[model samples]
Target: MNKSLAASVSPALYSSKTNTKIFTLTSAEHNIEVGNWKIDSTQLGILDTYFIIEQKILHGGKQEGSKIITLTSPNGLTITLSPTRGMSIINVIGQDMRFGWDSPVKEIVNPAFINLESRSGAGWLEGFNEMMVRCGFEWAGHPGLENGEMRTLHGKIGNTPASEVEIEINETAPYEIKIRGLIKESTFKKAELQTLAELSYTPGTHHFTIHDSLTNHADYPRDYQIMYHSNFSKPLLEKDAQFVAPIKEISPFNDYAQKGLSDWSAYLGPTKDFDEMVFNIVPFSKTDGSTIAALHNKDGSKGAAIEFNVKELPYLTLWKNTDTEKQGYVTGIEPGTNYAYAASIEREQGRIRQVKPGKTVHFKIKYSALMNKEAVNKVKKEITDIQGNQKTTIIQKPIAKE
Candidate 1:
């Protein structure tokens, strides 16, 4: 990563009658608004087309010695990734609108905070406010033996580091930006698992796509688990927001969620000491083989949606923790290859997926910000079409505000 910025020259157009400096930097990662360019006293052809990619090194904290990648497109989309943190997406900004949550800890911390020593993924939970990836080998739950190894919270994939990274920018006909990386987890003489992950965005679209290939190089078949822990907060997850999904059934994971079932699709303002709730969802299969989840803001004017292949990632986990303004006021719409349960439990239930030796599995997921009423309505109609005439059960309203 370059520690200092390099100067760039501006394009110049000199006419016998008029002179103007048209500043333009091509194929550069960072740009400075030096000044506006004018041609023939007319503001006719000024366009910003190139996407920017820059690296920043943090200092004086747990994030010290860490490298973070920031991808910015001309369409007002900004994504930040921490390579040291399993290439986890820490933040996302679309159309000058914040889509993901922000944690109390503003800087990236050490991966040790979520190491094996800290059981139950409590360490990972402490800093769990991002578009994070979870549970690769030994999922965190049940705390039982997994092939003679203990299980802990979700898994350690989010804490794992990437071994290789490649960034590609296409400025030609089809303008797009791509980030590809590899994360590996293995034992000295045991299992070896790797995931090739790619995130891509094209110009003129307010969306991005994630494609992952999980491979096992072990001599024997290896069980693996993964979940896309994508979260939404604040402006996007406002008080009157609604959760829409084409799910066959919704099971409350705990009493709190069971009690709030009536308003399960609705959101509330951040309240003090609000109990965190989890809901397990079984998505309905479609001929197109895709599933979606959307959150429409208070007035239903705008929203955001995520789509994934139900065949590859079968489970969905909806997490709500509107505890407080500063502590946690966000919700997560997670899609996983397996239910986030004890490895032994999922294996016993035959929910665990296996990658045969020398074989690979692939998953494709997309996320888009719905910028208008029509976009929000389009997603709602899709969900309804999938559900058909199945009567969705409606329960009691949420606990009334004091």
Candidate 2:
């Protein structure tokens, strides 16, 4: 560990063992706050290494009081997660590449400063700058009136703060690091949902996995939805970039998107005032229900891929927003339990998911950063194999619910 990474701490607050170590950064119930701390091989009494975990609190502007946890892996991969914002991953950087787009909103913007119900239900965009953010736990979709109540865009989970956060490390070789966060959304006479979100990363790797378990604490059955909005931009996303996936069926989400059906899988350079387009797709999966999706540059030398279980996330949404660079040029590869329609429309379409009393639902996704041609080719091949002998149906208009 680097000497400059050490922080002054009281031994009584944490364990001094050389094996696995657990740190409780914040727990309101336990009244604990290991404010602004860092740990590495030096503190663990092990061999010198670059692996380190640090937690810091931001103070200033709309980001005041936000808690950020950063994990620096030995393989030159670093990721920053915001526990203050539903444990969303804000940024990811590898030796020669970076994930995530440059959003107009520059600050991490603490949940306290965000108004999810403002702007006629589109206020969620005010604090949206994460590389990966979960959109649901209640309802995630377009803003509209559902049973006389305004359903905000993407729901409130993205703006909800985590009640507790913990960090754990493995004792043996590979030394995997896991960051866990607990977020709960409850309303009297409405619903109660608790989600345990965990992100795991191993040393010497350009990949990480996210595992989320959501349980209904309500006494009666509850309806819920979730979407993993993973966004990317330049380097991995640019002119001539291609989105590779084993498409089983696909259709435009609206009339606007229908105009770009011919070039749906290809991206364009940043254009002034570009109209965003969205495509809804059903991807082909392997016999075991696993699927892969990748976004690669023109020559396929640089890319990013996501592997997931189709049984967990049945639908995929492709979002293309190629507006001017300063106005936010980005694309989203989203997987969710349901489509990106209004909650009421999805319910009418029988796509809304439900959780029985005390029952839990699980979701797992793996993200890999491809920095070389070999890695990019490997993922493309996996997608091709899954697509074998399958005829992709391209519908001309938005899919109509039966």
Candidate 3:
């Protein structure tokens, strides 16, 4: 929001010498970095902590905008910390899509939104009206889970002292950043960075990859709903927009959409204030095809597509919140690690991935844009070299299903 960069745009970050693990800022834009920190079973003990490089952007300035990025813990396995940029809150004033941290979702037994808690057990979110944020990035269009479900990290694991991580910046690499820390009780190490780049006349786009590993040390089974809560502006999606995925049914939220409850969960609409929603999507069915899915408009113009290593996360969720009176803007495309308390009533019944101590399991998902038919034809030709050797991907669509 602040156009002036001289003072507000200088290098910035949150850091501490004590055993700290996370860093946050909200100056020019919102950014959050999950650093390495010490953890002790003794309860609030030593934690090998990490911090952000100080020279990025000053946080906590007079201006409040939007949260630029958020790096949640890979092991704690809960969506607890989300740094909103300017202002955000839950819709307590109007409609609450039936949410409670203790247990979430209405018709199903699983949770959709991430349930975050502060290190001090402080209530989630800085305020009420603006509650629960991924403290990360919003998507180009509405999220996939909006079709019927939504999700985020929901809980915290491990023990340690000092809730926030400290930071100090360096001038080297210009574009590269660094951090260090370790969660005491966590099974995996933490790595995350948040930085900004000033584009030139061309108006460049942000391109990067998210890398992490999941290791389960617990003796019992460990299931993770691994994913990114791709956010979007509902207003931008509009009424004429449409969604497509690999699955056959939608909205298990509807009491009678499928063959009995088994095949029943599917529906259609600009479902609510958030826009439209599609649930229980299938996978990209072919190598040249996709059981996952893509979205489009009434005319079959430019939209988006989602496909990943099905083993990484088999299901994709399209979520939206139309309660404009309650929440300002909410739309999401969530590729799920597990069914939304859908398909099955018991969480244990799902494919809860388990890792033996000293062993690690890993997975990754790619979220990109969707272009129109003209654009696709351009890229397809480029791929075979009929065109120039540009490697940029055109948003492709999966073949449609009945």
Candidate 4:
């Protein structure tokens, strides 16, 4: 057999026409060549997976100075990470199912992706939505800084950019790929904090997982806040879509949501100048300490689900916006340690968390999608079985937006 053609054949099987006995080498440690034939371990069918990673710089726009790294899987999963923007997953595509929202801004590569520049003292709302945006290490709300500096919409971490980015691919059995990045948030004479985020995925499965560790390297104890802000839009979040979560109780952020309390899980069509609603979901986790939240179309054609550890992220926030096209209609599934209130409010509410110097905290979350009825049922049953038919109360409060 020709050397090139024999390389593709199963080494365990003999080609009678070749008049030679075959021996399969399962290990990739050997480089045996005989009579111009080379035995390649990768072609032994040990694993079926492939991945590609690319780093590129943007140009011709405000984001021109920005940079991004993209990781794609052979099984139809593509993720774009902004190392210059808190290492956030700006875009996600998988199995004909898209989970991220379409923001009013068209790009995530620049500071212009952020909406408002000046602060009006209202809850910070100038954020640019991405597939997954990290919220904080110091404060994640709209109140002014401790030194009286007006706070930006979201925290500064999302705009801080990563320092050391690493990518690894292993073609071993149960093939996997991982991307790790380090981001730091510091002040002039204050404490410094760092977050190391690792995102991993396996081909042939519509799932991805995140593992993060935040460390407070300051000499004294410091307060910290963090959240995983994941958004969904369009086809999966269409009119009549349903939301399922293991909620123990829910609190509406304003009167608009109060009036729509009965249909908190119901989605409506976009309207002109529509008011956005925010709901705080107190979820119940399974015995393993994990909770689940999901959304699916009315006809169950497409959907997405998320699982997180309640111990790490006890608070879940649901953001619903059905405004006009220009304003952008979207929904967000947020899990964090604190609510999306002013830093002062969170402090007063005793929801802010503190980390001992030299101590590290870990957070993990998993994401999967449903492309058909079978996948939908599996997610529904999992959530139902995790939390029984427990009814909870909804508190109503009002918030303002300019």
TM-score against truth, every candidate = 0.82, 0.94, 0.45, 0.83
| Weakest 10 consecutive residues of candidate 2 by summed lDDT | 1-10
Of 2 and 4, which scores higher on lDDT? Answer: 2
* lDDT agreement with native, every candidate: 0.69, 0.87, 0.30, 0.72
Measured with C-alpha atoms, the lDDT of residue 330 in candidate 2 is 95
Residue-level lDDT of model 1, residues 1-402, one tens digit each, is: 111111222233212112222222121233222222222111323245545566666676777655577777656577888766777888878764677786676667757544654654346665465665555653543345667665656677777766555554443434566666667788877679887777887755788898888888889988777778888886778777899998787767656678877677888888898897777777875787787888888887888899998888898888888778798788888888765556776777777878899998998889888888899999989988888876654333321110
Best by TM-score: 2
Q: Against the true structure, candidate 3 has what lDDT?
A: 0.30
* Model 4 regions lying over 4 Å from their true place: 1-47, 112-127, 143-147, 397-402
Candidate 3: regions farther than 4 A off: 1-153, 157-207, 217-221, 234-236, 248-251, 254-278, 287-292, 297-302, 342-348, 371-373, 376-402
lDDT for each residue of candidate 2 in 1-402, tens digit (9 for 90 to 100): 111112213222344346666667777566667779888866766564558889899999999998899998757689999999999999899886888999999999998998888998899999999999999979998888999999899988888888777777776777788888888898999889988889999877899999998989989999999989999998888899999999999999998899999989999999997888899999999988999999999999989999998899999999999999999999999999887888988898888989999999999999999989999999999999999989999999887531
Candidate 3 TM-score, C-alpha based: 0.45
lDDT of 2 at 93: 92
Best by lDDT: 2
Q: Higher TM-score: candidate 1 or 3?
A: 1
After TM-score superposition, the amount by which residue 117's alpha carbon in candidate 4 deviates from its true location, in angstroms, is: 5.3
How many angstroms is residue 121 displaced in model 3 relative to the true structure, after the best TM-score fit? 13
lDDT of 3 at 276: 32
